[model samples]
Structures are given as structure tokens and as C-alpha cells.
Target: MMYTVIDIETTGQGNKITEIAIFKFDGEKVIDEFTSLVNPETYIPEYITALTGIDNSMVAEAPTFREIASSILEITKDCVFVAHNVNFDYNIIRNEFKAIGLEFTRKKLCTIRLSRKLIPGHRSYSLGKLCAALNIPIEGRHRARGDAQATVTLFQRIIDTDNSEKVFAEFLRRTSKEATLPPHLPSDIFNGIPNAPGVYYFKNKKGKIIYIGKAKDLKKRVLGHFYDKTDKELNLCRETADIDYELSGSELIALLMEDAGIKQHYPEYNVASKRNPRAYGIFTYQDRMGINHLAYNILKNAPSPFITFFNITDCRTYLEKICVQFELCPKYCHLQEGVQQCSHYKIHTCRGVCINKESVKNYNLRVEQAISFTSEISSNKIIKKPGRHPDEEGFVLVKNGIYLGFGFVENTEQIINTEDLEHFLIRQKDNVDIQRILKRQLITS
Candidate 1:
């Protein structure tokens, strides 16, 4: 492969390249070189000068990136552009070209990643650090031309040290060209993706979305579908045509995006919760004598709102357990046959309420307590919980220290309005899953 071993001296964190250089190579040997100093529109930070010795005066007479970009691209046209941190240099070049209305796409390679692979043991791998450790001389250290030349030599040494077969094997796997993607993807799509925490989308060449997924480790999870570890993942990966993603501030946002994304994209791999299925929520209502009872009821059709549910068995199971725990009559709760004194009454477990052996007032109190367990009788305030990042924010809603549900908000202003508090609350089917998770979290927190 034609290799353009390149380097750039940039403007600090802004990363705008002030100087660029490329040592063109045929196979493993350097054949030619190109280097230039660009007149950046911004002031060169002092630290950058101390590091690279390229002061403003030195670059005053040099041709700018716009002046040399065409020639630079011409020289490196057929080459695999190689650098220490390929992304930094490549993105800078691409951005510069893009600013001039040119689209620059190239095959890229990172010496840092390559060294980490080829040279298994190294305390540090910074260009300067590695040069010192490996005995490569640095003429200009941080200057683009000097750094590019040094990197070329370093690449040569790396090639000689590692067997060509071994290097090629891993190289082949690493490059977008050589590796097989998930069966559903277009070639090399995973190339454009970043290894950040985010939600991802899969699309075909036609740009039709096929799937959506989220990951704490985006690259690995997207790559995992192709793994041989589990047949399931392999099969799932096979059907994935293209992958796309959004970087979330944290895993929480990734999950939120994932939840909304799957619904939007409607990926076939997704199995659970298809666009909010109407859960047959279990509900409770006060009858003639004011006894609380459990029954299958339309969650949205209730006279008053009731707890939502997903687990059909647990819907009934949960309410029955609550009734039993609170000594509510199964008959009054509509869980037993006929109102002629429940089985609980015969077994002395009903407190004689069903048979009127117990006062209506006493039974009514217990009934109220049990119904209150599942009903949303009040809506005074909603509190959202914060995320786990540094700039990350969470909230707790308390009216007279009465804890409402913990919710999440983006910023301070969002938390000011009660709408933010209520809106951010994740609307889960008031199923046993939600009750269980929330109960445990709220109690523990």
C-alpha cells in the first residue's frame, strides 16, 4: 500500500493545523516527502511554540493550508494516510478541506494503535516518548516535517520488528476494507463510528434504518454482534446492515435514546416493549361498603388513574399478596366466588368484614390502606434523580419532605418548572416490574 506518513502541528485544543507534512512511501520504504507551514488565522498559543518551536514569525511567510491543500492531496491521493493519532490529524485535514467545499475521504492508520498491537510491551507510546525509548532521533520534535520523518522511521522499525504476516493479519482485520461486517451492514460503515458511549442506528445503503441499539462501549457492542461467543449475537449481527449512533452525555441518555430510537427505527432484533403495548393494569375500586378490592381493569379506562402493569400473573399476584398482607377480604376484592362471606372469613383471615362481623369503619380503614398502595391519589410534586457525571445533574422532589418519584432533568431551568419534574418521569407500565424496581430504589435510596 502507498503510505503517507503524516504529522501536523496544530493550534492547541482547537486542533487547527498550522503546519503539515507527509513522507510518501512505497510498501515499507519512504520514497518522497512534502511539508508546509500554514498561516493559521488564530494566534499560536505560547505553549505550542515552546513545544514545536514554530513561532508566529516563522509561519508569517509560509503558504497557508488553502495554498498547499491541493498539492498535498495530489501527492497523498493513493496512499494510506498514517499518523500517531490518525483521527486528530485526519479530522483536521478533512475539516480544512470541508471548509473549502471539498470532501476528503482517505484510508487512515494510527501508529499508536498499530504500536500497541505490534509492540506488545511499552511503558509509553507518545511520539517523543517512543522516540526516546526506541533510539530514534527527533530533529524538530513537534514540528510537522520533523515529526512526520521520525514517524516514518518508526513505522519502518515496527515493520522490521514484527513479522509481515502477523502485522498484515491484524492490519487486515483493523482496516475497514479487510474485515467482514455484520451481514446487514454496508462495507466499512463501522469506520465512521466513534468508540464513545451512545445510541447507534443501522441503515442500508439506501439509508433505510434496519436496527437501533445502545452501548456503554459503542464500538465493542456494535462489533459484538459479529462475535462467535454466542450464536444469538452472531445471528443478530448478521442481519444488521448498517450502524449509526448518537453520543450521549452518559449511559442514562444512551438508554433514553435507545428506548426512543428502537420505536422510531423499529428494528427487527428488538423484542420487548413494542411502541407501548397496552398492559392490562390491575386496579382497585371502593365498593358499596367501602371495601378495597383487586380486579383486572383497563388502565386508561379507570374512573380515576390506577397503577399500570405488564406482568399478567404478577398483576393479579401482586394485588393478591397486598390484599393478604393487609387483611383485605378476597371476596370484597372480587378475587373469590360470591359475596356470601369470603374464604378468608371462613378461615378467620378476613377480620369478619365480609360477614359484617367486623365494624365497617375498621374494615374501611384497612381497605383504604390497601387501595392507596396502588392508586395515585395525589400529584403534588414530582422529583427527578440526577445522573452520575460531573456536569451531570439530578433532582429530588419533596413537598414537606414527602418523597415523590425520582425523575431526571437536563439543566437548572428545566428543574424550576413543575412540568420538568412531571415530564421527565419515565412512563413505564405501572407493572410489577416498575413497582418492584422503584420500590427497591426508593426504599434503598
Candidate 2:
């Protein structure tokens, strides 16, 4: 089969191609070559220029990708595109073609994955390191022609390796994910991911967790990352080398597990939940007239809060519900500020506590009742869910309205109260995010 070993130098920020090189081989010998420095029409970052030695001035007089597009299409036609990290080159080219209103598609192979399969035990599979170890000299190093030429040599060596024909056939199969997976990730590892509810962790080369996600179908969700064409997903996949997962038996537990894992590892890619969310607290106090008043403030300012919420809107919403339920004045509850008496638009349940139509003694009694209701809603509870396997049961434990953790127990075990679950509990810290997760579960249950 004919193959075109290719490489491209890109402007790091926008990934615009600055240079490209292609070497066409007919399995036995090189028959054609194409190399060019293309004006990217964008700024090249200093770091990229320093690495590739391809600066703005060097490509000023060179042809743009648009000018050479047809040449590239002609030379690479009917050839299996091959590269050190094939997806990076292939996707960048495809995106460039897309920008110009053309579709670019080609069957591709990654030299890195092939090397791992045929020539195992290498410390690293990066083109530079692997080539150096094999004593294959790279004349231009970061330059497109040099890297592409080195990749060609590596590809030839991979072809000549024992059992290469069978390996190639397997990789070329329509159903094989070898070309779709991250260059650093092994197919076996990807295949091992079960189609079950779980929390998955994406780790870098050093095994450091970089992203965490919860999924009802772990395999499908993980595979979605590979198919996503967004810049963030591309960058994430490029850095990911390994994956680790913990089965949670159900989606609810998977969410809880995912939250705990992200908080613990503080993975770089998990941006939303990393920050400590500011909390708003609802509190109660008595005015000079001995009328009980409910108010909300930032958690730090509201000492001994009756109930807490992650945002001011939710805090206000909860207070409104309690105010209407107990017939308390909205003015006293801080829902309406700078008003002599409660005149809330949606809430007309006030018993004239603000207007003095109701006695302070009677109003205080209902305020106390509201406080009791709040405590009842936030009372300790347990949520039961399906287990990881048959004959097993899973449960989430909450005490005093705070999430303690989740765990599994055998169906044969006769468990009674929350105390019986402490033995199997996987303790986790309570946070606004976790609270939100559990609140949804409570609402749906």
C-alpha cells in the first residue's frame, strides 16, 4: 500500500500550519516528496518560533496554505496518511480545509502507536526520543521536512518488523479504535473501560489526574471525548495518557464520586468546581418588638445559620417559600428592603406582622413553627440505590442535612438505621456542589 508520511509545524495558539512536509512511499521506496513553508496569516508565538526556528520573517515570502492546497490534495491522494502523532497532523489539516469550505478525509496511522506494538519496551514513543534511541538521525529536528523524513524511516522500520502485516490489518479494520484514541493511551486500556455507571479520571503521562467526569455509560462517555473536535477536547486528549475509574453502581453515586474525586485531585481540566463557592445562609433573630425575623446573609456573617444555600437567589427563594408557608411578613424576612410594611408582589400571605395588624406574640409563634419546618426538611436521611452487582445494595448517607458519603452493602445484610450504614460508608466532605447534587436526588426521589 502507498503511504504518505507527513508532518506540519503549527502556530501554537491557533494551530495554523506554518510549514508542512510529505514523503510518499510505495512500501519499498520513496517515490515523491513535498515540502513547503507556508505563511500562516497569524502570529507565531515566541516559544513555537524558538522551538521550530520558523519565524514570521522566514515565511513572509512563502506560499499560503490556500495557494498550495491543490498540490497537497494531489500528492496525498489514495495514500494512507502516516505521522508520529497522526491525529494532530490529520485534524489540523482537516480543520484548515474546513476553513476554506472543503472537506478533507483520509485513512491514517500513528507511528507512535505502531512503534509501541512492533518495537515494545521503548522508554518513550515521541518521534525525537524514539528516533534518537534507534540511532535514526533527525537532520532538521523540529522542521517539517526533518520530522516527516524521520517519521518515514520509523514507518519503514515498523513495516519490516516481525508480524507487522497482521498488526497493520488489525489497525486498518473499520471497527478498530487504534487511530481514534490518544497517541499515548493503549487500546487495551481503552477497551477495558466497562459500559457501567462510574467516575472516570483522565491522567497525564506522569499518572497525575487532569480531569474527572461521571457517566451513566462509562465507555460511551469516554469515547465521546475522542470524537469531540473542540480545541479544549483536542488539547485534553493530547495530554491524556491513562484512565482510571471507580464503579458507583448508579448515576447518583457516580455523581457523588465524581464530585469527591475532582475536589480531592483538583484536576487541571475540572474548572467549574475547583473554586470554593461562596455560601449564603438563612438565619433568624428577634426585633426590638420581640417579633421573630428571618434574614439571609453571607455564610461567614450569618453565625449559626438555620439553613445555607450556594447562591443568594436560592437563599432568597427558600426564605420566600418559608415566609409564605408560615404567613410571615416579607419585610421582616428581608425579601423586601426599605419598606415600612411587607408589600411583596408574589407573597400576600403576610399576617400583618409588618403592619402591626397581627400581635407580636402570635407572629413569633408562627416564626418558630417555620424554623421547625426548616429543620424537618433538612433532617437526616438516607438514599438507597442499585449496587455494582447483583446481591449488593448501595446507599448514600446524610446526617443533620450534610452529605457524609456513599457505600455498598450486601442484600443479605439486615441493615436497619443510619448507624448500621456507618460501617460501609465511604466518608466524603460536604460542599456546595455536593449539596446541589444531593438536593436534586432528594427532589427527584
Candidate 3:
């Protein structure tokens, strides 16, 4: 197949393509290579200069991207445009072409996703990162020409590595509908999913929430179930009458609803992390006077509606690891509070809070530090994030000292105003699931 592997370097915030390189390949060998530094018509940020080593001064006299549009079109004719993070680069080039009243049409593929699919279990699949991990020579990590060259080499290796059967199947998957899939389902079951990051609901024949899921790539995850070899999924697909979904605008919102929906409607097919007795877990500790800290005794009974963990073991394991790292006494943390400094203090892992060496004041402070997802428990604050659509706003809430849910607001002033703000936000359940979502969203942000 004819291919043009392209790479681009852009002005950071403005996202204006500053340089572009294209390598034309006819299956086996490269026919030609083209590289150009285009005047971004904006100030280059310092970080971009440090990373790409391409300065604004260098592109000052170079031709603008508009000047090379025809050349690019000629080179990429009858070719699939391929790149690392192909969508970002392809969109930038397409947008630039559109600016000059030219319509750019090309099939596109992302090598980052391809590499992850083709070669699994690498720590990272970033173009430069994968190059380093695989010992691929990358002299110019961020520049257009250099990255383009690296991608061509990487694509060459991918073709060599891909199994004939799997590659053929994947190729067919992209090009046509699957013939092996159940005839009862629509040919466009795959096409039904959207690429946006959001929550997806799978409703069964009874109009019940059979399954709720979240994905950074919603389309990929939903389609994956159809292709999944799991026995349960196969059974679910056989019985599914129709599908319904709510676009959450964010995975955080999706996850919050996924958990809530699962609990609210215990579908026959779904089981993991259901809000049964084992829904949440907490680590508890006793003070010097033998008082069981209500903080430690977290379960369905615990008053603060903060949901933290899937299992007790997971909670213990995570807290133990954190305690050792931060020198937090396992004793004070309700993990191992006993007579003398815990085993960790003797082993030099802890600062001897268990042995009364560090003041309980300091030890208690450390214990509090190790806690999380309780920001909703501690701080009464509203969270703001980039909206899903250009016209909307996105948010997760902690309102009136409760873990309110996520929603959209139209104006910035509503979020900025404190006392009247809670009235305007899309209110959701202050349940443990929402609390978990809020906590995770904060940590990620």
C-alpha cells in the first residue's frame, strides 16, 4: 500500500504546526522524503525550543505551511497518512490545509495505538519513549523530520513483527464489517460506539442497566466486548436486545455513574465491585487510651460517606506501602499500632511512632497525610475541568460539605461564585462512588 508517514512540531499552546515532514513509501521502500520548517506565525514557547531544539528564529525565514500545501498533496496522493499520535498531527495538517481553502482527505492511523496492539507490555509507547526502550536511534526526538524518519523505521519493524493471521484479521476489521459476529446484531454495532472519553451503558432487552463502563476510548472498549472471548460477554451479546448510553463528557463522570448504576441496578451479568457488603474497605487503628478511632473503623457503618477501596487486602497493602515510604507508623495508621515501635521502626522503615518516639501529634498527622479520597471528607471545595464540548462546562462536585456528583455549567461565573454555586451545578448522589470519582479526578489533575 502507498503510505506517507508524517510528523509535526507545533507551537505549544496555540497548537499551530510549525514544521512538517513526510516520507513517501511504496510498501517495501521509501520513494522520497520531504521536510520543512514552517513559520508558525507565533512565539515559540521555551519548552518546545528545549525539546525540539528548533527555535522561532530558525523558522523566521522558512516558508509557511500554506506555501507547501500543493507539494504535500502530491506526495501523499493515493497514500495512507500514518504517524505517532496520528490524529493530532493529521488534524493539524488538515486544519492548516482547510485554512487555505483546500480540502484534505486521507486515511489515518496512529502508530502509538498500533504499537501497543502489535507489541504489548512496554512501559510506554510514546514515539521517543518507545524508540529509547527498543534501542531505536532517535537523534532529534521532537523535530518533524527526525520523528518522521523514526516512525517510518518503526512502521517497517511493525510490519515484520505482525503475525499474518492477526494482521489480516485486524486489517479486515478496519476495512469491513466482521462476518463471524452474530447475525442478530447490526452490521454497525462497531460503528455505534463513539471515540469520546465518557461513560457507556449497555442495556439489555428488559431496558435494564446490564453493564455500565468507562473508557478513555469509549468506542474501543464497547467494541472490545463483542470481540472478547470471555464466556460471559458472549452470553450477554447473544441476549442483548438493544443498547443505550449517556455521554458523560468525562471518564470521571462515567466512572462515578458506572459504580452508582451497578449498585442501583444489579444486572444479572455484572458482578465486580458491586456495592455488596464488600463494596468499600478501610484501615482502622486504636489510640493510646484504647479508643477505636472512628476514622479507622471504615465500613458501611462508618459515618463519613467516603468510598475508598475494593477489598481490605488492597487497602492494607496500599497503606502499608505508603507508611513505609513516608515513615508513617503502621501503628498510628491502624495497620500495626501496638506496644513498641512496629516492626518497620525496628527495621528503620518507620520513625518509631509505634514506640512513642515520635509524638502522637506528629504520628497522627502522618496517618492523616497517608489518607486519600477523603478530600470530600475534609475540604469543601468544587472541582473544575475542561468541558467535553466547546459550548459546555465540565465539573465534579463537593458541595454543602457532601460529595455531590458531576455535571456541566454554561458560564464561568457560576463556578467562580461560591455561596450560589452549588445551586447551579448538576447535582448527583453524594454516594461513595461519586466520592471515589472526585478523589481520583483530583489526584489526576
Q: Which candidate is the best by lDDT?
A: 2
lDDT of 1: 0.65
lDDT of model number 3:
0.67
**Candidates ranked by TM-score:** 2, 1, 3
Q: How many backbone clashes does candidate 2 have?
A: 0
Q: Which parts of model 3 have CA positions greater than 4 angstroms off?
A: 1-175, 180-182, 203-211, 260-268, 271-275, 279-310, 317-327, 334-381, 390-393, 410-414, 418-420, 430-445
The digit string of per-residue lDDT tens for model 2 on 1-445 reads: 9999999999998899999999999888899999999999988889999999999999898898889999999999999999988888999999999988888988889999999999999888988899999999999999999999888888999999999999998888889899999989988899999999999999999999999999999999999999887778888988989999989999999999988887788898888744777887889887778877899899999968977777777778788887887888999899999999878899999878777799999998998999887777677877889999988999998888878999999999888877888999999898878887775564345
TM-score of predicted structure 2: 0.81
Q: Write the residue-wise lDDT of candidate 3 on 1-445 in tens digits.
A: 7889999998867577888999998757899988999998889999989978889899999998788889999999988888876656766687788888999988765576567557777766668778888788876778888889888888887777848337534634555433223223334554676787776677654566677777777877777776563446655665554565667677776777677777777777877653543544454455565423323344666555343554455555555555565666555555655545456433356665555566667666655555543434436666666567767767766755576666676665545466566665665567655655554454445
Q: 294-391, model 1: which lDDT tens digit per residue?
A: 66665666455355454455455665666676877778766777658787533336778777788878887886776665444222334333454445
Among these predictions, the greatest TM-score belongs to 2
TM-scores for candidates 1 onward, in order: 0.46, 0.81, 0.46
Report how far residue 409 has shifted in candidate 2, in Å: 1.0
Tell me, what's the RMSD of every candidate? 18.5, 4.5, 21.3
Please identify which of the two predictions, 2 or 3, would achieve the higher lDDT against the true structure. 2
Q: List clashing residue pairs in candidate 3.
A: 285-334, 331-336, 331-337, 341-355
Query: Which residue runs of candidate 1 sit more than 4 Å off their true CA positions?
Result: 172-445
lDDT (C-alpha) at residue 149 in model 3 = 88
* lDDT leaderboard ranking: 2, 3, 1
Error of 2 at 415 (Å): 0.7
